[model samples]
Target: MELRPWALLLSLLLLPSLALAAGKCERLVITGSPDAPPLLWRDPQDPTHLIGATADVLQQVAKDLGVKIDLLYGGTRSLALDEVRSGRMDILADAPLNLGELDNLDYIHPALVQTDYLVWTRKDSTLAYATAGDLQGLKGAVSERARLTPAFDTFATQHLNLQRLPTLTPVFQKLLLGEVDYVLAGRYSGMALAQTLGMSNDLIAHDTPIDQPGLYLAISHNSACNDPWLRGQLAKKMTELAGSGVAQAALQRNLERWKAQLQQPVGTQTK
Candidate 1:
C-alpha cells in the first residue's frame, strides 16, 4: 500500500509519544532515608520495609501513571544512595537536590517535599531565636550529620557557638538541662521524638525553620530505564502533585502517623 501524506503527518505527530512509550519504565525499584521519620523510615513491624510521606506520594503517583514500584528499606542513608547510584535501585524517593549527584542522577523537581529543620529550646530559656543570627552568642546543639544550607553553615561556623552531637535526643537533653541554649532538629521528627521522650511539654519550636530543604524524587542515570521520558514524566507528575495539594496532605498524614507510632507502648516503640 502507498503511504499517503495524511498518514505521514499523523505518524510524525505521534513520534514523540511513541518514543516516550518505548522508553517508559513500568516497574521501578526505589529506596530512601530509613531513619528520616514522617518522610521516609523503616517500618517497625518489618525492618525490611520503608514507609511515610514519600511512600504515600509515590504510591499516588504510581497509581496515576499506571506503574508499579517497590519501595524497600535499603539500609543506611549512604547505602540506600549507593544502591541507587549503582542502578540496583532505580530511584531515591526522598533526596535533596545537590550538584554533586547531577552526574549520576536526574532530579525530578518542584520537589516532592521539604525536610524542615527547626530550632527547639526549653520553654523557660531566655534565648529569642528570630533569625539564625539571633543564636550567635547562645550555645546551640545540632546533629553532627545534619546538612545545613551553605550560608547558614558558614554563619553558624563563624558566629555561633555550636555543639555537634551524634544524636538529637542528647542535644535536646542538653538544651532541657540548661547545657545548651537550643537544639536544631526536624520539625515533625523532633515533635515525635520529644513526645516519645515525654519532653514535648518542656520545649517549643521557633516559628521560622532553621533550614527547609526541598526533597525530590531522583532517577539514577545508571538504571536501564533512565531516559528523558521517565525524567520528564516524573517531574510533570510531581508538579501536579504539589499543585493538587496531594503532597502536603501526604506529609500531614505521615506526621500524624509518626506521632501515633511514638505513642505506642515502650517495648513496642518503632524505629
Candidate 2:
C-alpha cells in the first residue's frame, strides 16, 4: 500500500481549521435585576451567583439549545437594560416592554410570564379608595426609575404626592413603617418580598390591578447570534422546553411553594 503525500498534507492542514471552526461560541450573558426575587436574584451564599425563576427557566432553555449561560448581576432595572442595549449582555429575562423599545432587539412571542401592578397598604390602614386617582390626596410610593405603563404614568402625573423609591424593598419598608400611605408594586414580586420579609400579614395587596404586562426575553440587537436563523432556532428550542412541561411544572412548583410560604404564620422567618 502507498500513502499519498498530497492527501496527508491536506488532512494535516485542514484538521486544525476544522477544530477552530467547531469551537464553542462564547457563553451567553444573561443580565437581570438582583433584587427581583423569584424572577432574578443573586444567590445569598454566593453573591456572585444569580438564581431565580427566570434563571431556572433560562437554564432549561440553554440546556435544550446546548449552550452555556453566564449569569450577570445588574442590581437595578436600568443597569440590566443598559447591559443588553450596549451589547454587553446577550439577553434580559422577565423585562417589561415599557423599559424600552425592541425595534432593534428581538423578542420571543408568548412571553414566559405576565406581571401586574398593584397597590399595597397596611392591613388596618384607613386608606379606602379605588383607582389611581384615589391616591391624589395621599402620599404614595413607587419605584423611582421605573417606567410605569401608560395608564399608570398618566395617573401619576395627575397626582403630586407620589414618592418614588429606587427599589421595592425600601418601598415595602416605607409602607410597613407608615412612611407612605400606599406602595405600588408588581404583584408577584411584592408577594414574594412580603413572604420573605414576613410582612404578608401586616400588609395587604388591593384587589384592583393597575396594569398587566407580558415579561419577555430581550435579545441584544448587536449580538453576533442575532439573526433570523438564530432567532428561529432559539424560538424552536424555547417551544420545545415549554412543550416538555418542564418549565411549566417548575413554575407551578415555585408558585405553590411561594403561596404556601405566604399562607404560613407571619412570624415564620426565612433567610
Candidate 3:
C-alpha cells in the first residue's frame, strides 16, 4: 500500500517534464518574399519552396541547432507576414524589424544581413541624388509591398511624390519608360533584376544608400518553438554568422547563381 503512494508521487513528478518535452519542436516552418532575389526567391523548379542567401543561412542555423526547417514560398511579402502572424508558419527567414509586428513575433538579435536600399535611375537622367530630400519634386516608383526604414517611409509619405505598383518588374518598366524619375530598391536585388530584364545598361544605382536595413529571422510568438532556449540559440548562431562573413559570401554565390540560371535556355533553368 505504501508503494502505491510512492508510485503515484513519482508519476506526478514526471508529468510536467513530459509535457515540456512534448512541447519542444523538432522542426520549424518558415516563409518569406518570393521576389527578393540574392536574399531569397521562389525556387522555380519547386514553387513551394524559397532559395537564396537567407535560405542558406537558415539551413546552416537549422543544422547547428539540430532541427529541420522548411523555407516555403507563402505568396507575397504581405501574405507571408500573414502566415507567421496567424501561426500557420513558425518563422520568417528574412524580415526587416517592424514595430507593428512586435506583437506577433520575436525578432532574433544580430540580423542575418544588412542591405543598402539604393535609388535607381536611368543612365541619361540628370537627377542629382544626394539625399532623400532631393527626391521631393520628382516622381518615384516602388513596389506597393516594399518596406523601408521607418524614418524614410514616413519622409517619403509626407514629402515625396511616389507611385506604388503591384510588383517590381512593372515598377522598373515604368522607370525605363520615363514615367517615374527614379525607383527605390535593394542594391543586390536591383542589380540582379536589371540583369534579368536586360536593363543593366539603361538603369544605374546611385552610389549613396538611401536606407540600410538589417534583415532578421523572426519567430512567431505563437510558435511551439518560440521558447527561450530556441530564441537564445538562434540569436547566438546569427551572431556567429554575421561575424564569420558567410552570409556575404552566400549572397555573392547566389547572385551568380541567379545570373547563371538566366543564361540557361528558357524552360530548362527553372531552379
Q: How close is candidate 3 to the true structure, as a TM-score?
A: 0.89
lDDT for each residue of candidate 1 in 1-271, tens digit (9 for 90 to 100): 9889999999999999888768568899999988877778888887788988889889878888788988898888889999999999999887877889999988888888766789998898878777887887788899875766767778788888998998767888888899988998888778767876889899998878988877888889988778786778888897787668777677788878988887679788644
lDDT of 3: 0.89
Q: What is the lDDT of residue 13 in candidate 2?
A: 96
Ranking by TM-score: 3, 1, 2
User: What digit string (tens of lDDT, one per residue) describes model 3 on residues 21-41?
Assistant: 766789899999888888898
Ranking by lDDT: 3, 1, 2
Model 2 segments more than 4 A misplaced: 1-27, 74-76, 98-104, 126-130, 133-136, 145-147, 233-271
User: Where does candidate 3 have its weakest 10-residue lDDT segment?
Assistant: 143-152
TM-score of 1: 0.86
Q: Which stretches of candidate 3 lie over 4 Å from their true place?
A: 1-16, 19-23
**Model 3 residue-pair collision total:** 0
User: What's model 2's overall lDDT?
Assistant: 0.73
lDDT of each: 0.84, 0.73, 0.89
Residue ranges of candidate 1 with Cα displaced over 4 Å: 1-24, 266-271
What RMSD, rounded to one decimal, does every model reach?
4.8, 6.5, 3.0
